[model samples]
Target: MSYLQKGNSMIRRTTAAKGLALAAVLSLGLTACASSDDGSGDSTEGGGGSSEPLKIGTILPVTGTLAFLGPPEIAGVGLAIDDINAAGGVLGNDVTVEWGDSGDSTDLSVASSTATDLIGKGVSVAIGAASSAVSLGVVDQFAEASVMQISPANTAADLSGYGEFFARTAPPDTVQGPAHADLIMGDGHCKVGFLVQNEAYGNGLRDYIQEALEAGGCEAVYGGNGEGHEFAPGETNFGAQVTDLLAQKPDAISIVAFEETTAIVNELVSQGWDFNGTTYFVDGNLSNYGEDFDPGTLEGVQGTLPGAQADEAFRDQLTTWYSENESGELEDFSYSAESYDATVLAALAAVKGEATDGATISQNIRAVSGAEGGTEVKTFEEGVKALEAGDEIHYVGKSGIGPLNESNDPTSAFIGIYKYGADNTYTFERQIEGKIEE
Candidate 1:
């Protein structure tokens, strides 16, 4: 019931550099005031923390190709902290966050520096690095320092055992991949081609779904092995790749590129591909395409994004919270719920384990997340109260992430199928329940 298995197991559905002079000033300033990452999670030794507050550092894509994701993620973590503090804080001390930018895969150095800076600031838990590759760039730094690294949207399947310190609220592509394949097959697309990026995010996901397609008696025309084409990071010109894939004559095309998706879609349209009919987009390309393309350019496109469709009330609340607190617009909610859940889970782990350092939180996370449940609690307030009463608790996240498996990936999650309309924006068409196999 905890881990989803298939074939007797289950399946589940699943930033910037500055000028040199300014850089020197910033480097020295940061080093001069940074705290030690001695597994203490205490900042009284240096910076970004106080004697009592629990410090959570964020290394999300605040700037870069994935910058569109930053607003909601930041808002999500912010709201969780607000709610926790309102409920009397973690361990009777407020939770403070240090923000850092995680540039996309094209620039891992940005994320790496920010992560090291945060760890040096003595954070017990850090949330972020949205892209799977982005997370990979900095996860080891945190793990080595005994800092918990919880991600909102690093969904690559191979990242399952990255480290004891690494865990993700986002379900892996192993779940979402099969869901996408099933949807395509269900829609009667027997021949498919893939146009994905070269990085782990695209290639890894493409591999998972290709297995499902073959298993379902479908043919992967251009996505398997030597035939599959991979675009290097920042290589926006998908013209040649599109032409070669068109020659493969797939009935359906699944694109798994990121910001470069805008250009790829444009080229696809130029090549006379009726995107409205046989095009599939993955989370990386499943945004309100109207923002980049002309209206109706992405109409009829279908895609899969991990996590449940946040109900209207939750969406509105997050929007309002972002407007009032974060001084930004909630352009997208793709990973908002997951972000909130990850942040809240860290705080709850701190409470349940009676400690706020990285190793302590890591040891308690699975226990607090229903590994061996003592009580079922949802909100941080409820969880804290239950712990106060000497009750062990299981936290069912607001995002609905199920109990984590041995690999620290969620055992159960929701994969939302999305369909675009005339406006290039998409709406949730249905929810696919995904389970992870042992």
Candidate 2:
């Protein structure tokens, strides 16, 4: 079966099991106003009161294409919020969050509408639209409304140039792309094959990889969009594409795709391809393949990403929290850590703003995360202290510390190299600097 057919089957199965009411809720048009209550917990209030509580809006793919990644991202946000509240809330006001699902749509008009509704209800900061395409769709709306949007996992190259009001924790695809290409071409490889998804995320990686490969004196044997069908993030069945790629007999194959790449990996293994000699290079989106693909099939595969695995200190804290909470097992992915950092940064910005308004919050973000100050921020408390002292703070997060350029994108990110082991686990090989020139 083709990828499109596989995607359709999965959606049908899920919808049938969830029933019509849930599906209706999922597909319902964006509501203009979300019901709100005043301090008395009754329906009477003009503003939720500047002194009452802090409201933050979150947008993530909770139900559709990128659903697998949403839970961890949301968990990270929740963790940051809990930690802040436990520490006596920001600026002495209780913090609250309202969440909306983005459903992985390329055109995020519905999600943008949801954000506007959150703004109407008085949220000062918004975090999410996990997919880059979705983030790109709603950036203008956030800018128009003066809402500070801090995305946890938007890596598209175009987003940093969106506006001053937007910020992303994840490094752009351009940074990750060249790193993967270097890993493949630097291994004395001559020719490589490419299988890319037809989207901004896929094309961005493809462009960077091609440039890096050519620079490294490697040639591309087969380069184009992956065939079989257009599959959303979680779709399966890439057997035909893999079979065609195997026919080319390249030294390596670069998969600039997502979960669909896992299916191709499976097909390659099933066909008894020479795994010892041929390499499979995947982008950061395939970081979670261990959870989705057969363990034995992924042995010897390689992947590149912008950040390292959750540091030991942070993982210990998260493990303790999960033991006391009902959020379930946390997967080890870069986005989870980035999500926590983004939320913390935004909250710090809000506290720095003092008034809890988006414009003030946006200005504070640039002040704290930018390079006007010394480039080091160790903890949330230290950031708060710096902001309180009227000193420009450079927020160093779990991802890394860097300056946001004119585009609002971080100028650099730590690049991590990972290899898949026989047990279907990803082992961190090493870290490199992702430095790109304008």
Candidate 3:
């Protein structure tokens, strides 16, 4: 099947599953209500340790091929807000989020405009533009406005290097790709093939994985020919590409695409190609596999992603908070844990900066991450303690230890591997440590 077919198939499948909810939300603009706070009509007015409410904006794909990733990611953000508010809010003020959708276009222009609008509404800090392409487009706008933009899921390497104003909770492709490659190659695989989307995230992951494989003494059977450059989502057929890939007879194959992963898996299964011994690799996007593809096809497929929320001690507390305060269900998705952490970090930064403005918040982002002389911190209490002691702190987050290098990418941690089990379950495999090149 061609890339176009794979995308088409994905659209059809997602539409069938979510058409009603999408239509309902669109018609009523209830998508905007996803961030609605449960409060009476009374206004709580104050600022900077006053009783006023602090506003934050979130720009995520509420309606797009990547929609499944949005709710969970937002849930993380919301859970953070709930916890902070219950404990007297940020700096004694309530924090509320203004939510917007990036839509299916995922265009940077749209994202920039959205960010501009949010800044106009006086959001001190913003989280999201979940898609890297969309975030890249709007990053400059946020910088110009002096509004801090922290992405929960923007893992493109370029975003971190863009400026200090931009940061992300997720590790970039530099770490993620090598982690996947190590797992694929460490299994004694020699020949490898890659399928990548023709975007920054996809291309970067493919390049890093290829480099890692080569370093491990494995040859990439198919490289530089765009043999696997598929752009767009909801593609249904990948027969032609699969046939080409099978011809290479690689010992393993890594797919660096989002949203359309299940289609590729299903197509491979349909063609009678068993993945039993052949390693199949996926990135953070694999969290959506169960929801996007038939469970039967996904069984036994191996996926490499950031540490799972269930596997983290801090996430247990988060899960409890979410269950008690939110009406939505929570799951372990790519940016869910990180998104929550980003909000908490931003709020803590605001408190440390002694101001809730965007510029101060952005400047203090690295501080919250425990850069400089900052003490190693994680929870709100740790940060407060460090501040009280007048010490620089490093935040080892629930996501991982976030020691961003000069490039603004994380300098430590490993990608976790998991395998799909029966009944749409996932089991932990192992951690693949990644080396940073350059």
Candidate 1 Cα outliers beyond 4 Å, as residue runs: 1-37, 40-51
Order of models, best lDDT first: 1, 2, 3
lDDT, candidate 2, 374-436, per-residue tens: 546666777767766766778877777366665667777877788877677778888887764
lDDT of each: 0.79, 0.65, 0.64
Greater TM-score among 1 and 2 belongs to 1
With candidate 2 superimposed using the best TM-score fit, by how many Å does residue 104's alpha carbon deviate from the native?
2.0
Range of the 10 consecutive residues with the lowest summed lDDT in candidate 1: 5-14
What is model 1's C-alpha RMSD?
Answer: 8.5
* Predicted candidate 3 versus true structure: per-residue lDDT over 269-378, tens digit per residue: 77777665464656535663455545555566687876444456555655664455443555655567778778888887777766666656665667667666567775
Q: Write down the TM-score of every candidate.
A: 0.90, 0.81, 0.80
lDDT by residue (tens digit), candidate 1, 231-314: 887887878888988999999999887888888888988999988769998887778765677788888889999988887887
Minimal lDDT window, size 10, model 2: 3-12
Q: What lDDT score is found at residue 203 in candidate 2?
A: 69
- Considering every candidate listed, which one attains the maximal lDDT? 1
Error of 2 at 205 (Å): 1.0
